[model samples]
Target: MTVTVVVGNPKPASRTSTAATLVAKGLRPEAEPTVIDLVDFGAGLLGWGDPAVAAAARTVAESELVVFASPTFKATYTGLLKLFLEQFDGGTGLAGVLAVPVMLGAGPAHALAPDLLLKPVLVELGATTALPGLYLSDRTFADDGVIEGYSDRWRPVVRALTDAAKVADHA
Candidate 1:
């Protein structure tokens, strides 16, 4: 089973990335993971027709589960993620794929941003979204730039993702 994550955090060392890393690490051994950082691709995002972008999109298309991650920008997912997702032009969307939306922000007020904003987009992409999109407070989860320090509330969320992955495997 393949599970991939498309991360939109701009910094090389970012909390958003860390959160995704944590999720990837938790996947079942049989569930191989592909974690792609959009910033690492650079410049020709619109040149998505390039071999690399095409390859990455294929990874996304083939994965049984996808963690679509981003550092909340203006209360929504980053443009970097938007660019990467634009590469899925085959009109397949994310059909037959399960998605876990993740968003990190400076304040707790934006906790609902993932569910309210990102989830809809993931659905439009044709992916079945796991409930309660993960949201981490930059202040609480990113101390000294370390995202490994998950908040007390993050446990159940992790379990939810794990459960979803199992369900997707069966489906």
Candidate 2:
């Protein structure tokens, strides 16, 4: 399966990116995900039609599963992520892709940010979010079993959905 991890952290190679990569690996250990760290795009996200940004959007759109992750900024996702998301063709850009929203926060105060805030945007962009969004503590995401636990519970479901989506796409 084509799995991708899109990190919206303002800092390139931040902890958020590492957590996101771990989440992707937990979901599909065999798949090597294409990691898109939005900070690398820099000014390219300000306007439309940049080749690299467009290519990144296309890569996400074509993936079977994508983990859209960001650090909780001001109790919501970072604007960098929003800028990248804006490249899509609203409602159809992400059609047929399965998305998993992930957010990292310093504490549990904004634990619901992933589902309450990010998931809706992914849905609006036409990605299917069958599983609940994942919220990880930026402080302890690596040592914590949260990603592994989530993967253990939802991996089979993800596999089923991706298989079905592939069939539907072919049909």
Candidate 3:
């Protein structure tokens, strides 16, 4: 399966990226996900029709599964991520892709950010979000078993949905 992880953190190689990668791997150990760190895009995200940004959006659109992750900023996702997401055609750009929203916060106060904010945007972009969004503590995501726990519970479901999406694409 083609899996991709899109990190909206403004910092390059931030914990948000690492946690997102971990989540992608936990869901599919055999698949190597393409990681898109939005900070790398820099000014490219400001306007439309940047080749690299467009390419990134295409990569995400073609993926079977994608994990959209960001640090909790203002109790929501970053504007950088929103910029990247804006490259897509509304309601069709992400059709047939399965998306998992992930958010990292310093504490549990914004635990619902992933589902409440990120997931809806992905859905509006036409991605199927079958599983609940994942919220990880930025402080202890690596040391904690939250990623593993989420993977253990939802891996099979994700796989099944991916299979279905693939079939629909062919049909």
| Top-scoring candidate (lDDT) | 3
Q: Model 3 has how many clashing residue pairs?
A: 0
C-alpha root-mean-square deviation, candidate 2: 0.7
CA lDDT, every prediction? 0.73, 0.94, 0.95
Local lDDT at 90 for model 2: 80
> For candidate 3, lDDT tens digit of each residue in 16-106?
9999999999998889999999999999999988999989999999999999999999999999999999998889999988999999999
Candidate 2 lDDT, 90-143, residue by residue in tens = 899899899999999999999999999999999999999999999999989898
TM-score for model 3?
0.98
What residue pairs are clashing in model 3? none
Q: What value does the lDDT take at residue 150 in candidate 3?
A: 97
Each candidate: RMSD to true structure? 4.3, 0.7, 0.7
lDDT per residue, candidate 1, 119-146, as tens digits?
8888887877755577877656644433
Q: Candidate 2 — number of clashing residue pairs? A: 0
Q: Which residue runs does candidate 1 get wrong by more than 4 Å? A: 27-32, 142-171
Q: What is the TM-score of each candidate against the true structure?
A: 0.78, 0.98, 0.98
